[model samples]
Target: MSFETALKTAQDDIQATLTDLLVAFDGPVGDAMRYATGGGKRLRGFLVLETSALLDVPRERALRAAAAIEAVHAYSLIHDDLPCMDDDNLRRGQPTVHRKWNEATAVLAGDALQSAAFEWLAAPLTHPDASVRAELVLTLARDAGATGMVWGQALDMAAESAEDPLTLEQITELQRLKTGRLLEWPCRAGAILGQADPVHLLRYAADIGLAFQIADDLLDVEGEAATVGKAVGKDADAGKATFVSLMGADAARDRAHALVKSAQDVLLPFGTRAATLAAVARYVVTRDK
Candidate 1:
């Protein structure tokens, strides 16, 4: 199948899995969880599924991992939109969880989603081997916790108040933790599922992750709020230094392109089997939203 088709398929499957998994919970939190996970490109989940496929892992097992990552991603978005955070009112062109319900409800919903992600990873359905499940759980926790995504978030919050704007290197480190780790987790999880070496996949994920962030920076500067489905220009308005702000739009775009090339080049060993994955690297930099 084509890469676009595969990506869309992955998105559909992951969304269904998330919906089914959360169907049993009946409450405001449950509804908010559903709402928060309702729409997105599902890029991280797609990475899990695609990388798993490259390793010949079982589809059911891969699907569980994909859903787990999506849950974690959705939880991050919900919390990131909180008033104490990015204070975003819109997400995916819809009211953010905190705005739709309330801050307390949004917090509870995000908390539940995060917990559910670990629960899914720990479940036998995710992998028959307990060791594999354990590794997935441990790595995900580390990557999503204070040492990873949270670290990035903390840095971001601090950056907002600092008298000086962050340097390019500092911002790169922050983005790697805040965004790259989650993106890397899916590829790493895919390798774990198939018991394959993850060196190349991990490397590919790192490049893709950075490129994704740079693309996001570009979008923030050039994309329409309606098309992007979120607030735009907020980064600049807030006096935040982004890839674009630090490197200029053309330089940032070129850097993203170079990262995409590096990402795709690393997949050469997989040959045609990795075409879709390679396509994703290019898509990250080229996508309008």
Candidate 2:
């Protein structure tokens, strides 16, 4: 199958599992959860499933992590669109959770989804070995908690009012935590499940994660709102520094290309089995959304 076909298949697979997780709960919170997760590229979840495939893990087991990561991703987007945060009214070309329901419902839905991610990770179905499940749980806490995504968000908020704009290194570090950490988890999670060394995937994740953000920054600068989803130029509107702002547009694009190369190179350990992942790394730099 082609890469696009494989990606679509993975997206469909994870969404079905995600729907099952949500439909069991009924209410506005459930509605909000479903709404928040309905669209987008399902890129994070795809990373999990594809990595698991390369590692020779069964899709049945990998599907659990893929669903869980997407739940966490949905929760993050809901919160990120909250009034106190980015205050976005639109997400994926539709009303954001807070706009569709209310702030309270959005908050509750995000909380529920975040909690559900851990619940999914802890489930025996994700892995028969208690130790592997525990590792996923522990690493997820570190990546999504105060030290990771939250840390990046906090830094971003702080920079808005600061006298000096963030330096390139600072912004990169912030994005690595805010965006890179979550990206890191799924790639590494596959190896953790396979009982194989996760070190190489970590390298791949690190490169692709940064490239992903840089590509996003490029989109913000060059993409139309209709195509990009959400509003374009949000970072620039907020007067926040970005890779494009710091490194210049041409240079930022170059950096993302370079990172894609690094990402593909790291997967050499997996040889031909990793071709799809290498394709994904390239797609990360090219996707308009």
Candidate 3:
């Protein structure tokens, strides 16, 4: 199937599973869950499924992993949109979790979503090795937690008052830690689930992860808030380290294209099996939002 078709199918499965899971809870907890997961594009989940498919893992297995990743991503978004963080009033073209509900509810909801992600991963699946599942859990936690995304956020905030302007290298390092690590985890976890070679998988994961961030930086410059579903130009306004801030807009676009090409090159070893993922890399660079 085409990447778009596969992405939509995986997204539908994730939404359905999320809905089923959320149905068991009621009141504020349920409301927070729905608010967080109800309307995003499901990019991380789509990556999990697509990467798994490329490595020939079963659809059912991919779906389970995708659901878990989506939960973590939703939780992150909830926290990121808090008044203390991005303070975003809008998300996915709707009120942010904090805006829709009370701040306390939003915080608790984010906590719940984070917990639920590991719970989903721990559940029984076709992968019989409990150890492997545990490792996947650990990998995701590290990537999404203090050592990775969270660290990146802290650094980003620090960079705001930095006396020296951020260089391209510094920007790349920050993006890798903050945004790229989470994107990389999905593909690496899928590789583990599919029992692929660790070396090849890590290489592919690193390339695509960096590519994803470059695309994100490019989008921030050119994308609209209405289309992107988040605050636009926040990077420049905040003086955060960004490719576009270091390089001109056209140069940043060129860099994004180069990264996408590099990602596709890394996937070439998988040949035809990697086509969808390769397409996704291109799509990441070219997408308007």
Candidate 4:
């Protein structure tokens, strides 16, 4: 199958699984949860499933992991859109959770999704081996918590107030922590499931993750809100230092392409098995939203 076809399939399956898992969460909070997760590229979830598939892991177990990552992603988006954070009013071309319902509902929905991620990871259905499940839970907690994505967020908030703008090196580290870790987790999780080394996929994730962020920066600079599905030019309006702001659009685009090449190169050992992932690296930089 083509990469686009595979991606669509993965997106559909992950969405279905995620929706089914959240069926028990009823009422406004549940509605917000479902609404928050309704649409996206689903790239992170795709990484989990694709990497796991490359290693020959069972689709049933990998689907749970894929949904788990997406749930965590949705939770992060919900919280990130809150008034105290990015204060985004739009997401996925719709009113953000807090706007659609209310702050309280958004908070509860995000909280529920975050906890539910761990719940799904801990279940035996994710992996029969308790150790595998344990690793999945522990890794996700570490990645999404204080030392990883949260740390990145803290750095971002700090950068907003600091007298000096973040240097390129600093911004790279910030994005690595805030964004790279979660992207890396899927590859690591896939490796754990297959009992294989994740060094190559880890490298691949690192490169692609940065490229993905650069793409997002480009979208903010060049894309319309209607096209990008959220606020555009917020970084510039906020005087935030971004890849585009620091490097200029042309240089940033070049860098993203370079990163995509590196990402694809690192997956060479996996050969044909990594084709879809290579396509994903290209898609990361080229996507409109």
Candidate number with greatest lDDT? 1
Candidate 2 local lDDT, residue 186 = 94
Task: Rank the models by TM-score, top first.
Answer: 1, 4, 2, 3
TM-score of each: 0.99, 0.98, 0.94, 0.99
Report residue 31 deviation for candidate 4 (angstroms).
Answer: 1.0
> Where does candidate 1 have its weakest 10-residue lDDT segment?
2-11
Task: Please list the residue runs of candidate 2 whose C-alpha ends up more than 4 Å from where it truly belongs after superposition.
Answer: none
TM-score of 3: 0.94
Tell me the tens digit of each residue's lDDT in model 2 across 134-182.
9999988889999988898899888888999999999999999999999
What is the C-alpha local distance difference test score of each model? 0.93, 0.91, 0.80, 0.93
Q: Could you give candidate 3's per-residue lDDT for residues 1-289 as a string of tens digits?
A: 8877877887789888778767767889778887788867777778888788877788887777777778888888889888887789988888888898889998999898888878877777736789878878889999998899899888877777789878888878888888888788888788888887656656666776777787788778788988987778887787676777778778877877787788788887789988888888887777766
Query: What is the alpha-carbon lDDT for the whole of candidate 4?
Result: 0.93
**TM-score of model 1 (CA atoms):** 0.99
lDDT of 4 at 192: 87
> Candidate 4 clashing pairs?
none
Tens digit of lDDT per residue, candidate 4, span 184-224? 99988899898889888899999999999999999999998
